[model samples]
Target: MKARDLIVLVGVIGIVLMMVLPLPKMLLDILLIINISMALMILLIAMNTKEALEFSIFPAILLITTLFRIALNVSSTKLILGEGDAGEVIKTFGEWVSQGNIAIGLVVFLILVVVQFIVITKGSERVAEVAARFTLDAMPGKQMAIDADLNAGLINEQQAKERREKIESEADFYGAMDGASKFVKGDAIASIVILIINLVGGFIIGMAMHGMPFKDAANTYSILSIGDGLVSQIPALLISTAAGLIVTRSATKGNLAEDLSTQMLAYPKLLYIVAGTIAMLGLFTPITVMSTLPFAAILAYAGYRMQQNLEQKAVSEEQLEEEQQIEEVRSPESVINLLQVDPIEFEFGYGLIPLADVQQGGDLLDRIIMIRRQCALELGLVVPVIRIRDNIQLKPNEYIIKIKGNIVARGELLLNHYLAMSPGYDDDSVTGIETMEPAFGLPALWVDEAMKERAEVSGYTVVDPPSVVATHLTEIIKKHAHELIGRQETKGLVETVKEQHPAIVEELIPNLMNIGDVQKVLANLLREKISIRDLVTIFETLADYGTYTKDPDILTEYVRQALARQITQQYSIPGETLRVITVGPTLEKKIADSVQQNEQGSYLAMDPGTTQQVFQRFQEQIGRLVQSGYQPIVLASPGIRMYLRQLMERTMQDIPVLSYNELEPNVEIQSVGVVNV
Candidate 1:
């Protein structure tokens, strides 16, 4: 084993030996000196550590040191009782501190015991117990904050992990301290008990065994007992003080001495007041002027000097700030920085501050984080961090959501009110401010908290202000999700899949199509509100059919056909027939005949009049389907599905066009309407 490990192991074994065996006076003296030195070192280290975690091994060290001290006491007690001399160190201490007065030495030792056990050890133990409880209680909140920062892109994954680990370490450290404090308390009690035993037992041995006179034996044993007690109690007091410091110390950038001086002497006005109070006491009280005037003069001088230093520091700080501002203005990078824009931005009016500020119970940021995760799950897109700020130019209750510097949606909210939407029964019994739901454009009302119960009783769905803005933001992101996935995002997605399906990505990318082509196909799928989460299937379809055509639109259609089961399950209600609108066979044949192809790809070559007639028929049939309360889905042949969707995309953006081949065989279909041209 290494030398350090061997030394530690031997040291621990030596401590156990000290308890079981008697020690020579010379060896006992050396161990006693070492104990005193170790206690002093512990006290100094505790004072210098800026945080508890900086000295995380302190609890284990404390246990070892406490054991070592008790073992030394055992050996010293044996030497003093059996041989009448514990060590030169103990005898010298007893003489120097007590000055031959055994009563004085005994009183001093008892005082130290009381101070350590009653004041420092007890208070530190209580503080450690409370600290451990509170640290564990706040752990969940700290973890959630870390997660929020990670999702918002404020910190990367490594930093988040480090923060989480630090929180856990803090909890464990405080818990260990809570248990370690008990050791110091028990050590204090052991000191007192050992002191009593040494006195009582030493007197009996010196008189009965050595046949000494009563006065001589009393003097000899009392002095020896007092000396031993003082030797042990002094180090115990120092260690107890150190324990107090460790538990009470708050985390700081500076050590204990620096923090104390900086905080205690921060304001010169307080020192000036102290100087004035001393002068008043010197003049108004019975105290002599000669004794008080000098101290008062010193206080006054120190206060004046501190005041001057404060003014100088303020002036220097102002000058430094001015220099920084001048440098920032002169820097060329400042101009370039203005051109950068956030991918997504959220701006709110001053009145809505409480809805975004965490301290004020605003959970808008948390909601935004959830929205990003939701988008990733449903649409397979990564939403960027939304930069939130306040705009004074807008109305007090208004907020806006923007994508890439353009405003997409805006809404207004009342801070102290809940929004209520009717359940389609046209119940107007509950009165409130009328408004429109920002997410769905349904009529809603801003009802006060007192009216929330009545609104609920009237069969209206109620929501809070933050929920309103979050719901609106969710919809806006879903609608513009296609634009968010670019070349970089597409590459990231492919690299992620490559970790799991390396062969498929390697065979398809750069061999049949590049990253940009794949991006376009994914974008097309997202544009039609189809999830690209099944990437393995999408890539497999591309690898099989990409050689036939390099067109992204055609590739997307093939990908859709491969994902037929997922698409059908997404739109179809379980155990219900799929309701759809079908084109008449004659009209389908006409569309098929109108298709034209060239090197540049296919296009519709029908006459303008015939195309107009087809569009009008679609409008009429879709309108009839809507009037009959049926969701309108256009069914067409696989060859014509893409063309049909392209023709109707402008006018029927919400309608989903499907091919017969994309439908599963087990799914039952019901044609609700027919189109003819």
Candidate 2:
């Protein structure tokens, strides 16, 4: 039988048992049956739909516990009546009522009822969601078929076929993104505004009704009721609903007005409930309208507040402007142009060596155009495009013809000329490889001085790397007369600075890579402007993971450079720096290696995409960095920060890693000083 049919049968049996069978004489049995029925109603609804069910279990439990406690107290109080108890019980009950216990009982009862209403509404919502899902599951199969014909050769038929099948199979179920609780900002604000207005308006209405000034009315009611009673409730409800309407209306671009109106149509039912609750109070009690008004007002306001908060959140113009600026800052074209290659023909890791070697830069232009087209298709965007406009020498031994373009959908394309050099890239692994490349370019440490200044200026939480250890690095290159030009330096400290195999460095010529920071620092140190001690202090002071200390400013430059390289290496957008911004042992070594290996004036800017990707890749890279005798430090988000702090504290007590969160707002610092071996 259907679940609904089974429910009906059970209900009928329950009714029959109530009338014909004496299974239990206690009222608790009846209450249990009622609870079961209520629960079943909720279960049926949720089983058929896809909405999330939110239950305030604590409130419900408290309400129930209080009611039972009151009941037991009252029952025990009646036990005081003995043989003359019949008359005495009645007299005592009357006395209790006369003494204002009745008023307290009524207040408790009202609160419990309100809680019940909330629970019921929540349960009904769950049921509706489940029912909707069940309805979707009942759709016909042929109607779900893919629109494309496999016989047509117009597209990649195999891929098309698979996509269609996947879509069809998943169509029966709603995606997490498609759920009704997709909250918006405008809705939330609207709801809150409306709720506040209702509260204020309710008081005004009560003042008018009581023939007193608003302030006097409030004071008077505050005495009789615990606070301003339900007299102000109706207006508050109206106001809150109106607020929700305004917010939802704005967010939906007026598409949701009808829904708001439909919800408002339930006001009459709310009124009935309110009226009935008021009427249920005893006439002989000292209960005043003032005492009950606030509760009613709160109840009336809650619905509007909830609806508004759930649906009306909006994105402001300021946020949009910021996003646009960020987009400009991270323009893939800039990163790609740094590498100096055409984007189209060279995407997907193909034709790299000859393209990089060829100087004219004409044969690669078509490939750059193709990349732009592909990005347009993928992200479905139409933003102004930027392309790599210059030739960037990335390293002495390795160079890529790079191209960059802005597509409408995908933001910026950082096309690397070296993809043509990497073997074994397929369609699936393309994005994966691109995502990983950025992590390799992160810096050993990121400084957040700019972020701190911005935070002070804006009065907002700053994203800066936490202060842990104070470390620095220095590299010195000497030009001596009479030295052979080809003289090889001994296997020096740089070999140990970065953990890569010496063989790999020899073959890859990582030293030839153009990383400007290392060169600049070295130059400054050689000029005696910055001491070697200061360099070591800077290096050692950074978080162990190089740039992952949750400090945005400190990591931004390295992240930007990494983004450039990642875009190039992964997506064939060539002008990426592939930087890693971190303070861990491994990251510090990488920085040292970059300084030691890279030629002067060879550094490049990375795309923003690579920076974000590298941040994400830190976990995996930490292990590699550590295995090479390099320690890493990682940053934490708000929720995880405390736990991470504790774990780090325990692990580093012996090694002495320091952490400080009070440096600047929203920025924490953790660092490990290098051992002077």
Candidate 3:
């Protein structure tokens, strides 16, 4: 395809051909020099990389280099045996190292082999294996931490995806290195084998075919063989060291040179100690003081210079920090940052900090995570990250929960005491500070650890401080869940459902209604404490009846009737009849007659006098239902149910107003009271 890719393919093919075809001495010499240069460059690059992943392609490079070296060994061996000479490079290397003495050259070659094979190669292989194992093992933990950060709103979806990809890449890079290290080890062994073959084959060929005596043949072939070995082994040693460096590199902010300079010389005092040691060793151990004194003086001077640099650096850093702080105060973005409000916030005083501190055995964060999950299941809305912090503005034992920067609920906790509430009536004998349960406003007492068991035995519901706070926080979120789901959040729900049920989404959305229309319906349901988890059913209903009316109110009524079974199950127990307050025919007629219509849609326009009478009568019925511990559900005809709800919403927001059709036919309903006006 492209020039570079073609060159790579040709290079690989040439390496294979080198083993079978005899190349010219000049070409072989050039190839050998190129190999050495490549190896040196690789070593330099490895040292400069800050992390192993920065050179992720190294494993492939290692394999290719090893193969190229082996091919060169084969070509060189053939030339010495067949042509009586391998190449000028090999000859120069052999002569230069041996100095016309073959024994010295052979010893030097053997030492390179021992160090490359036994030390560098072996250690690199082990480190690669361990690195790979640890990377793979840490993947799950890293992935979960990313998810937690995403849920906490510390990172967005794109950032989370990038983190996940990085984790997988690290695992793959280490695993490849684990296998690639073996090639370097095998290349070492192959070099030794090729060296032996070159020596034995060259000797036999020189004497048998070239008519040379034993002494002459030994001298000639010995230099050629050792020369070939030395030329290859030098590059192999460099590469082996490079491999070790790459695998052992950790993820830090700087390259090897930078890290070495900063960390090893971080303390100038250490250099002073080393200088003293050198001076003492020369003076007391009978070594020449002249030999060590100059080195010791240089070390002391360097330490002195480094200490001066450190002091100047500290002064410059302080100046820079002050300048940055001044600039930040003048910047518009600083003010802008304060304007951004968190969707939900939990602030507690200093004394209650232990409730959120993990080291103090507090599990408020863990509880918040669970609370978010519970809200998702119950309300079918993803609660935004609850920002938790300590505020010195409040009383020591006081805490407050805010929704959209406005304080919605506040409570005080006695961390050392357990909240004990009587089951039905007051327990005068259970002596403790009087308090009201913040979640439900029920009368309760804060009893210490001593009286906890006694209160429990006396039919009092006991809960710890964390649980009390968690319950209050949960109730506040549930009460305000409708405010949290806007068009953006509704779109999220629609996308989630689209992933699983595409047919309903594609046909319903933007065809009969848009996101805003769907948002209004979802908000209405959440406002009434209805779970929208069954999205497939909701979409199906919307698609079925959406063409008749674009009004969210009427559409919601249709959806409720379609979800009758769910609503029935929500109100009625398995074998118990549902008790409800019934709206009489006279009030229903008044509401139905008062329905007024305009271009925007219909709304209840009843007179204030009739609305007042209705509220007075509805509150009486609701009072009876509450005293009897029955959920105050107002049942009315389909035509007037929504109107009645609109009237009672402000006064009795927690009460459920249901139409007769919004219940299952098989369920029995008992009317406990009637409201007529």
Candidate 4:
């Protein structure tokens, strides 16, 4: 072990030895001096510490010091009863400090006990107990504040972690102090009992064993015992005062001395009042003028000087602020910093501010977080943090969602009203203003709060204003999630995969296909509203077919076929036939024939008129399937699926176009409609 550690270990062992083994007079004196010195050191350190957490080891120190003092008491009691001379320190305290009077020494020792045990120890224990309770109660709030700061970008992850750890430490420190205070209380009680035992036992031993008379033995042993008690109680009192200071200390940027000087003497007016009071007392009361004049004069002069210093400090601070503002204006980088844009922004009008404000019972921020988590689970992509702010240019009840600084969706809401939409059946009985749902463009009405129950009873889905906005925002993010996935996000996903399947990642990344190629493939899947949550299967498919082609679209198709079960489960209901629209033999043949290949890539080479005709027929078929109450999914051959999807993307973005190979074997496919040309 290191020297410091060995010394500490030896010191602890020595404390144990003091209780059991008798020591020489010189050694006992040395230990007594050391105990006094250690207690003073602890008191000074506690006073200087700015925060309790800075002295987190204080509880253990308190325990060790209490034991050390107790051991000293034991040794002193043994010597006084056995040999009539405990040590020079104790004998000198008895003879010189107490004026050779046993009664005087006993009174002094009892006063110290009362001050340490009744005043300092009792108060410190109460404060520590209450502080520990308050700290524990406020822990959840402190943790939430840290989380809020982290979410608002006020602090980074590491800083948040540090703050959380500090909070836990503060709780633990106060709790330990609460228990450690009891040790001090016990030590005080033990001191009183030990003193009685020392005096009684010493008197008995002096008369019976050493042949001394009753009065002589009483005086001699009582003086020594009171001296030892005073010696121990003085340090205990100092240590108790230190414990009180520590537990009651508030968190500040400076030590106790600095805080007291700065705060207590902050105002010169208070000192002026004190000076006036002292002068008034001297004149009116029977106090001599000479006695109080100097003190009053000193107070008046100090107050005047403090007032001057305060003015000068204010002037200096103003000048510094002005200089800082001028420098900020002169720096070109300050102007350039304003050009930065957020990845996703949510702008609401003034009236809609209450929807985002927590004080008004709005949980829009929390809902947005849940939306991001839901998207990550369903779409397998991390949604960017949505920055919400108020924009006065829009209508009072209007809000908009922006992706990369461009508005993608806008909606209007009535804060006090609920949006109610019919579930396919017509319900005109509920009276309200007619509107359209921004998310799906479905016909909806803004109904009164009193009409919510009636509307729901009428087979209409009822939603609040915040839920309306949240639903709209959720849809917009899912639709544009592909654009949110950049190279950095792709790298994070690769690293995440690498953590679990390192061999697969090493074999595929930068060897067969780079990160960009993998990103494109993932983006393509996301663009089709496919979940990339099964990244292991995705990477394995890429590694197998990536050697043949570097095209992201082709790679996406391979990945989709590999994830056939997931894709099938996504669209089809369990134990039910999958109703879909299909392309006829003639149209399929035409689409297959139109497929062409070049050095760049394979693409559709069909004429515009024929493509238009095919799209019209496909739309008609989809409309018929929708009218029959079946959600339409187009199933095409593998060769023409991508081309057909590209043709219909602009018009039928919601309808998924899947290839035949993408379907699972156990799922039954029922052809509800077919496109003919």
RMSD of each: 10.7, 31.7, 8.9, 11.0
Candidate 3 Cα outliers beyond 4 Å, as residue runs: 1-46, 49-105, 113-232, 239-329
| TM-score of every model versus the real structure | 0.57, 0.19, 0.70, 0.63
Determine which window of 10 residues in candidate 1 has minimal summed lDDT.
264-273
Candidate 2 local lDDT, 534-645, one digit each (tens): 2222233222224343332233223222233222232222342212213344433332333221333223232446334434454355555465454454432322222223
How would you encode candidate 3's per-residue C-alpha lDDT over 397-471 as one tens digit per residue? 999999999999999999999999989987777889999999999999999999999999999999999999999
lDDT of 4 by residue, 157-190 (tens): 9999999999999999999999999999999999
CA-lDDT, candidates in order = 0.88, 0.32, 0.91, 0.91
Of the two candidates 2 and 3, the one with more favorable TM-score, higher being better, is 3
- Number of clashing residue pairs, candidate 2: 118
Clashing pairs in 3: none
Native-to-model Cα distance after best TM-score fit, residue 636 in candidate 2, in Å: 73
lDDT (Cα, tens digit) per residue for candidate 1, span 143-165: 99999999999999999999999
- Candidate 1 residue-wise lDDT at 612: 88
- Which candidate number has the best TM-score? 3
| TM-score (C-alpha) between model 3 and the true structure | 0.70
Between candidates 1 and 2, the TM-score winner: 1
TM-score, cand. 4 vs. native: 0.63
